[model samples]
Target: MIEEIRIENLGVIAGARVELGAGLTAITGETGAGKTMLLTGLGLLLGGRADAAVVRAGATSASAEGVFLVEPGSPAAERALEAGAELDDGALTALRTVAAAGRSRAFLGGRTVPQSVLAELAEHLVTVHGQADQVRLRSAARQRSALDAFAGPTHGRLLEDYRAAWTERQRLTVELAELVDSAQERVREAELLRLGLVEVERVDPQPGEDLELAQEAERLGHAEDLRQAAQVAHDALMGTDDAQAPPGAAALTDLARRTLEVVARHDEALGALAGRLADVGYVLDDLAADLARYADEVQADPGRLAAVQDRRAALGTLTRAHGGTVDDVLAWASTAGLRLVELEQGDDRTAELRARLEDLTGDLQALADQISSGRAEAAERLGAAVTQELAGLAMASATFSVRLTPTPELGPWGAEDVEMLLAAHAGAPVLPLGQGASGGELSRVMLAIEVALATAPSSARPPTFVFDEVDAGVGGRAAVEVGRRLAELARGGAQVLVVTHLAQVAAFADRHVVVAKTEGDVVTTTDVRVVAGPERVAELARMLSGQEDSATALQHAAELLERSAVGR
Candidate 1:
């Protein structure tokens, strides 16, 4: 509930503070006395869009602040707390400011916050209805929502379930479609993977096999040249059996050693030289034996060379397609093998998804049927209730109906479209609300619908309700009924604020506030104050007639107030 509202520099409302409490509070003023500004201020506090043009002339900024009282653990309080707002004894302060330069800011519980936070809190705190809403009620979607709201909490839960199932069904439908549409593509992909795997398996390339084979092939190809080189070196190191061959290194070395040995008995230095020559002859003998063994082992084998080349060519085929090396090809095979397993299971996966989608489709159909049934039942009750209310609001002959037309397919809300229809009088053909009802009838119809919805067993009423001239085209007894219903709504444990021009409605209020305007040379200012006793009557009289002092108007205003008191 809103405890108080303070507005400054907004429109012609330079500065005004209005205190509010339980029950009905009526706000009234002359045509241009800034009554609309009061609601605009409230809208700002409720996080409505801000226009710099609303700022008072010569003022730098305009601001609206509201103090709201909420239950300790209410959703509104919890949301405020979540925004780092400090509630003072269950009272939360919301402030909005619009600078003349077009910038806007919002503050909640003394902390700066985005304007959306204020909007979120407003949903739990209050419900504001205006003439604009009466126009909105003509929409089919809006009618459906209103009917759903009146269907009680059980229906609401069922509707939520239906929506959840509907959402899941939609997702499953898309996925199943994709899988089915790409079936042939998936088959082709699996075939390609299978062929690649077969090719790799036939080659059977091992890690580093290509490199090893290359080295072996090179040695085999040069076998004859290697053998010839080894034979020539061996003949040079040791004397060959051929007589034409000159004395080899070994023969020369042995002769030098004997010459040194003969001189060793005559000189000690000659004996050391003979020992070095003997070591050289031993090294030459070892080299010659090694060279002879190498020449005999080096034999060209064409069959082995051809086999190595063939193996290399086979490994090369795998390399060119998959990688630059045999090891790379092996790595590719390992990854492709895993992917092949997945591709091979596509049919199984497709079957599984189709089965799940079938089950989900059945579930959705069941939920939609339940929702349609609930809506049909609730629509009848709500239509009857609102029609009953319309009778009291001076439309005794009018018939209100909530018509549910079955749709070809299920919608987000249900399997039908809801529309509100009305018959203005007996014998008049029933038409949609927008087409059949006049402005006055529409206003009454909107009020009657509100009253009917408020009486729903499972509907949770907001702490506060603001009606901005919802009685726009209503007057006479119809206007009085409007006030009576608003008062009853307030008396049922909620605060009701009605901005009205009708004196009958003003008379029904527990409190009356008048916005008086003062025109200055440079600017216009509005003063908002609560009126009671004769002052309130005078205000009502002024609303009834052009003069507050008119004797007949005052008498009528007093009589209306008396009747309202008795009715209350």
Candidate 2:
């Protein structure tokens, strides 16, 4: 139930704050009493699209806000989360503002939101029916939606699963189609990758091999000069009679031995000299062995050199173009291998696709059956309830039926088509609702449906239903019956707001709000007030007899209230 609604500078409503409660709330007045303006304000609050013309003549902007108490895990909360919105506990406060400059804004739970959020919130908030809703009933989509709504939780889950699988299948089919349609293009691409990968495989370079090879080539190129210098040093170190000869490995060893021989003669000094000569001999011997190895290994094989050069050149080509590393080439090869396989094996891909199609179709059929069965059960119960509602609205002779027709072809929804059929009087012959919904009969039919489904709200406080012109052409007994029906619908839950000129309808209200127009210097204003107790009687009497002082009208108004109390 809507707890409160406030409007400012919107159409004929300059400023108004209407506090609402659980059960039926009737707003009534004379012709041009701004009853429709109140509904317009409500529409704006519910996040309806706006026109700047709604702003008052002297105002730059129009604003509307509503507060509702919702259940903790209601559909409204789920919708909020789905839309990436946050709610304040279980309560919701929605505000919408429209500027004369053609700009509009919406706020939910104090955070700014897109108009789309408002549209979603409105689903759980209110179900407003003017003449527009009657026309919507003729649509197949609306009928389908109604059927789905009537379906219980089992059908709901099945429809959800079916939709999920259907979407997955659609996505897979699109990808498969793209891959198949571009087969020739894929062939060209595969050819290009194969050439690149083959070149890389031919080389088969290892990690860091290119850098190591570069270093080796530089060292080999300097081998000749290194060998010449090493030979000269060897000759100097081993010269037998040369003065100032550099001591070779053998000479150093002999000097160490001579020092050690005098170890017994010259105690400390000779011992130290011997140890130092021993260290020098060790270093000299190690150096001589390394030099010999270097000289021996400096091979001058031109053929081997040519082969190394050719290999290096081939590797360098790939390195410079792709990356200066063999690892990069390996990565490219791995990627291309998968593509090549896909391009070469078309039959295997088709087989996999056929298998996938079978699985998806099977899943869809199971889900559809679940949905259909649940809907069958829901339709039975819902049809019975709606039939009872119609009786309360004085349609006792009318026949209402939920017609479920099975379809072989599965659409986005499922394989069942549901329709609501009706007959105005006994033996009138049942017909589609669209054909029979004339002379205000459709409005009452929709009313019955809405009342039955009203409990399925997104919040604990179901939105107040606003019927702008439900009693458009109805009056007297029928009008009274409409009011009684609205009151009856409001019994279990929800706040019903009916804008009408019928006094009998107004008599059924727990609260009767009267809208009066007041003219000022520069602008005209609309004010609404709650008429209670005896004052309510005056309003009802005025609606009844077009005069407030009629004794009969007052007595009838009192009688209506007395009857209303007993029903409650």
Candidate 3:
């Protein structure tokens, strides 16, 4: 619900503030007293297109701000919070400014925001209807939604189930298409993986086998040189059997140790030197044995070297194809093997998906049928109810109906397109809403539809409803009915503001605001104020006649107010 509206530099409004609350509010004034400007300001707050021409003369800019009371966890409140807006105790402030130079800006709940954000939030906040601002229920989709909402909670659940099935069917259809389209590609991929795995298994390379084989091959390639070197070193370490041969390293070290031992009886330092020489002698003996064994073991085998080289060449092929090393080749082979299995299962998976899709198709058809049935039943009742409302709104001869046209194929909404049709009077052909009524009739038609929908058990109502001269061509008893219905709509916990010139309609408002124009030396300004008692009577009197001081008009206005109060 809107708590207040503030306007500045907008047309003849200059600066004005209108405090609003629950129930019906009537804005009435003289022909040029700026009543339209109030609704235009409201349009700005609703994120309507900004025009620099609407700014007051000599003013730099025009601004409109609205304070709305929203539920704490409602979608509008959540959206404002998401945009980093700070709501003051569940009251959201929406402001729009248009500069004379054509620049425009919007703010929501104290935070600057994109104009589209305000438009999006408006869906949950207000519904505006007028000769030029018929925004709600303008499309087939929205009409279908409104009808579905009127169908009650059971039908709503059925629609939800159908939607869920439709979503799943769409997902499955896309998945199946992908699998079928990529069938040939998967076959090619599987063949490549199979060939790579075959090569790896044929080589049978083990982890670290390539490096070990390379080392063995290197030793075998130079076996003769290695054996000769080892034999020479062995002979030097251990003395040769020939008596003329010089003493080997072990024998020389042992001789030095004995020499030191004899002299060490007189010196402790010499004894330590002898112990070191003894340790060196033991190391030389061990080295001579190891060298002799190495020389014997180091025999050149051409056949073994050839076999090792062949194995290395085969493993090299595997490494080059799959990886850089024997271990990497093995790892790649393991992963490829798994992929090959998955690729081989593609046909089976495709068959399963086809079967599941077929089943889902059947399910979707049944659900669509059920939804269409429910909609058809609801459409009849809704049409009758709205037609009944039109009679009271002075369209007694009119006939209204909801037409459901079946589509050739299923759509997101269902198997049918929902449209509202109207015939202006008896013997007239029924036509779509906009084509069948005049601007004034269309506004009444919209109002009747709203009142009819409000009677539905599951209808979701917007917080505020704005009607701009919806009573334009309506008068007499019909005008009182229009006022009664507007008040009735507001009584259902909605804030309704109607721009009206009819004293009959304005008299029924819970709060009546009169826009009074004041002429100054250089400029004309309009002041807006809530009127009651004599002031309200005078305003209604002015509406009934051209003169507020006319006693007959005053009496008539007073009687109309009394009648409205009793009807309320």
Whole-model Cα lDDT per candidate? Answer: 0.88, 0.76, 0.87
lDDT of 2 by residue, 389-441 (tens): 77877788887888888887876788878888888778887988879756567
User: How far is 58's C-alpha from truth in model 2 (Å)?
Assistant: 2.3
**Total clashing pairs for each candidate:** 0, 3, 0
Model 3 ranges with Cα > 4 A deviation:
2-18, 27-136, 228-292, 466-481, 499-505, 513-528, 537-563
Candidate 1 per-residue lDDT, tens place, 447-479, comes to 888878877778776778889999998888899
In model 3, where is the ten-residue run with the lowest total lDDT?
Answer: 518-527
For residues 1-568, what per-residue lDDT tens digits would candidate 3 score against the true structure? 8999898889888888899989999999888788889889988888799999999889999999999999999988998888888899989999999999999999998889999888888888898878654445567877888788778778888888888888988998898899899999999999999888878877788899999999999999999999999999988988899899998888888999999999999999999999999999889988998999999999999999999999999999998888899999999988998889988998998999899988977887888898899899999999998899888887899998999999998887788999989998898889987787876577678788877766676766667999889887677887888998899889988889999999989998999988877874111233688999999999999999979999999999999999899999
Ordering by TM-score: 1, 3, 2
TM-score for predicted model 3 compared with the true structure:
0.76
Clashes of 1: 0
> Which candidate model has the greater TM-score, 1 or 2?
1
**Candidate 2 global lDDT:** 0.76
Off by over 4 Å in 1: 50-61, 99-103, 204-335, 520-526
Clashes of 2: 3
List the candidate numbers ranked by lDDT, top first. 1, 3, 2
TM-score of candidate 2 to 2 decimals: 0.73
What's the distance in Å from true for residue 173, model 2? 2.9
Best by TM-score: 1
